[model samples]
Target chain A: MKISEIGEFGFIDEIKDNTLFNPDPVVIGIGDDGALYKTTQGMEQIAVIDTMVENSHFIIGRTGEWYDVGYKAVASNLSDIAAMGGIPTHIVLSTAFRPDMDVDDVIALYKGIKDICRTYKVNILGGDTVTSQEGAVITVAAFGEIEAGKALLRSGAQAGDVVAVSHTIGNSGAGLDVMLHGADGYDELKKAHRFPEPQIALGRLLVKHHCHSLNDISDGLASEANEIAKASGVRLVLQYEDLPISEELQRWAAASGTQAGKFVFTGGEDYELVFTMSSADFAQLQAEFPAVTTIGTVEAGPAEVVLCQGGKRELLPAAGWTHF
Target chain B: MKISEIGEFGFIDEIKDNTLFNPDPVVIGIGDDGALYKTTQGMEQIAVIDTMVENSHFIIGRTGEWYDVGYKAVASNLSDIAAMGGIPTHIVLSTAFRPDMDVDDVIALYKGIKDICRTYKVNILGGDTVTSQEGAVITVAAFGEIEAGKALLRSGAQAGDVVAVSHTIGNSGAGLDVMLHGADGYDELKKAHRFPEPQIALGRLLVKHHCHSLNDISDGLASEANEIAKASGVRLVLQYEDLPISEELQRWAAASGTQAGKFVFTGGEDYELVFTMSSADFAQLQAEFPAVTTIGTVEAGPAEVVLCQGGKRELLPAAGWTHF
Candidate 1:
């Protein structure tokens, strides 16, 4: 039947009439942007977003990594909450699939997703699935909650706050470059491209330590530092020599003739934490754990990210990754 | 860099480490199925589902009706709420597209969806978009709320209750058959295929007057009635002569040499309301609205949906649409 005949309102009414709704706490169902459920008093809520596309996100023949695709899809959203200091709980998956796509592929996708959910003790709960003349699409809305006073934001940096990174950078981006160019380091670079990790435990630790402010280095360190600067309303001075680069990434970059420095600074999709803390705390943290380094400090004036060499400060160029 | 190399846990850890979390409410994130959010003593939650597909759900060539396809996508979901006797409020769209699908087509789809949302006082809150190698896919998750104790279900039927139908039936199914056959009477049947009206207000009225059991007729009257009967655990005896068939539908069916009875009984996608209520209340409703008919009666004994003809009761044949 023509959808217009039912009209939008009419169609909604029909679906509600057809389905059964549980009636414990919710007063209404099937007529709002988000289903409403009862909650306890003084509780905070968590929210996360993730998107998936067909060809760009997954290529059938070329991607023998379907499992990775499914795993990454969920993990990406969960990372968003971890950054917020919230515990992961329930997820809603919204998806569309073409008729031609084998049901098995979908089964594999869900299997991977379910695996992660089971490991983490999270509920699959509910979601919507539809057919599309276009390709397959997946969007997940994950919910989490944190203590009332401890949710983190991106704007809490202070001057003399030590900058710490969770891991080496540029691997994912370099991996992508290698994959596209068919470079010599096929296996290593492909691995980086397919499976970059998010550091949840460290984020929780930072929250526990009352670290200044932080954000994931999605676009690149240069861009992420700029974000911290903008949010904290402070200037950041970086020492390029202090930046960490993995040995594998350095070898790949060297053989490919791609500057490891540029990759480290501008390459994104690292999914690593970039955070700030006071100088005193930096010393204390260093005394306790040697891996953390003071890469930069927050300054009071001139909101900018500057690279300090010897005694001179050079402005860092901005080159954020573009999706489209 | 293969995806497994990064590993699910590792990838999530990286994402979390790179993010800044507020310690106020969370123990952790990034590694769980769902995000944990703070709870409250009382909160209202709702859930709704919608689906869309490519060829079967939409058209692509000269024969294809893209605009109508978009319209139907949203209409179907909206109809769900209309049947539930509630008002729709929010929608989350999940879409998948092939590599070749035009960006403009995607935009048009959203425009159609947005148009409906605007009319229904619903908001397009958040959704995920992804790519697929096959065709396009779209799913919408809509949510709504109503006053406590006002939501409707399909398990409230009682014997001696009257059966009522909203508007006309068999139009959409006949319309589709007409279009598929490449027959003449294009306009009337096409309207049925392109524009369906969901009976929202009538459903609300049914709820208001305390409907015993209710459901929308998507898989034809007989099929949906069967659902009501099954769910309510009762037998239903329908009067064949009382089946509502539009004059136009009759003409179209006659001209096409299709049985009107079959169209009314077995054809699906009607989106009409089929409800049962106490005889006294049904009589009052029928008095107020003369168009409604007592097409069926709930009975004790084995759960069966039978049609009565010349004092003889025969089982209704199973003939309806199946999504899978």
Candidate 2:
């Protein structure tokens, strides 16, 4: 009867399983990455909130800059807004620090958050401050305005849509491995983990260019692709040989005794854009956005993401961080 | 310096002192009871986020029911929305719980929240769930909307305006004392603390009736009155003889060797409406809302609140719950 018995995913499912709709203004409520509320002025607004805890999400001793922690905290929420193809406009930060925390440390963390907001051209409107007997708890609520029909969704991918991933993958997973092992040739990966950049502009571009479906790459390409496939009622076939992994990632994966191809396929925290595009549009998109790589094809079948590896198609296991 | 060295209010000041506002459509930001953002549809929206930590905000072995805690959590946030004269629409709840939490117990808590939201007609939109190594952390972000120019403010009270308290005060404070005392005839007072009702409808009525310069009496009537006085650049003279104290509160205060009237005057978490109105409008309001009490008046002077007791006036001290 304890919480762990149901697990974190079960709890999330319990909350979102219902198809309840709020009164007149809310377009979408609990199930999506964010909620869509229609403004009385006929504008669609997106709101997303997420929280991160110390020692649970990040250890203080490893990658110990409070600034980096702040960046990760805000980036997590920003990624949700980006998934909706909305431009984040304002953020409210609520934090509870332990009694022993230094004032300057918290200030530096806020500064780091402000720097990220500055880079994104958003404002930190307001928040709350309270002390806790437990460790640090930070919650961020972000709001953005999106055009009436432009927000991307997980349920929009159709059969025959091509799966495309923006830029490379596995940098954060390799970075975390380096932080754990103190290994060489993975410093850049570690930085990538600490400060993952959210592709907001790319998300907007995808929505504008009529991408079939969109989701940010947070919990690995395989896991996220599986989510899109399940939500969209389609099957996905990914080409592992077509994966764009960096040379440093290959070097680090080799030193760690991990397969570079599998690392790129199943690693997480990339914060890259993984989206589905129409076959005709995909051809035109490839000629323009060279950073985008065609990873797979959507098909009408049971929801699954398979990797074409070693001339064989195999089901990819889900191996990302489960926050709960 | 340690957080204690900075103190609770000092910590809040330090956190918000340098917060720069790039208000694109922000009506009011940090330093208010809540953040006010002008919705894209030109309606005024109120958003407030607050966190409650186990052992810090409440004792684990308290006499109150878990349901009471859940209700109080939502009520506190709803009070903030009500203070801004906005109608509660949606709330996002982020919770982190230790592994020991019973699933049924959490469901009961959720039921309590659902009951209150149903009563207020607010929807539970979206939030996050995470496992905690420590005790539970509950953060609620409540959002509401009001007409563009109808949101009352603390800075709109003018000199010569009548200052009033919406109802009897200090019942929640007395209720807390009852919980700490463990035995008494203070059942109603204690219940008041556990499940305090927010003056949402009353606030809407006041705004509709053109009342100016309003705030909810959360941090004691005296503390909040002082806030209004300072924000409005007016002085407040509160007659102690006119303070409203419940009969049960008086009986409990006598047993505890405390001044019941003084507690009602300065104790916190009453969730009552406090506002100033023009003398002419005050007469009409008295006829409309007979439950309201006119306890003070605004004057042109140095911004401060004074207590008028036994024909003597003295400066009121700021004393309430300090969370740092």
TM-score of chain A of each: 0.80, 0.83
- lDDT (tens digit, per residue) of candidate 1 on A1-324: 433344434433432331222234333333332344543345566656566776676554454355666666777777666666566655567666554666456656666666665555444445555555565566776655566767766678888777777777777777777766656555655665566565576667777778788777766888878877877888888887788877878888788887776677777667777889877766665565566666877788777888876676787755532211
Tens digits of per-residue lDDT for model 2, B231-274: 78889988878877789898988888887765675666778888
Q: What is the lDDT of candidate 2?
A: 0.72
TM-score of each: 0.70, 0.85
Q: Candidate 2, clashing residue pairs? A: none
- Residue-level lDDT of model 1, residues B252-316, one tens digit each, is 87888877767777776677788888888877776666667778788885666888766777877
Report the C-alpha displacement of residue B185, candidate 1, in angstroms: 6.9
Off by over 4 Å in 2: A1-42, A261-266, A286-288, A317-324, B1-42, B60-63, B320-324
Residue-level lDDT of model 2, residues A60-140, one tens digit each, is 768547888888788877887788777776666678877667656675677668778778876555566677676788888
lDDT of each: 0.64, 0.72
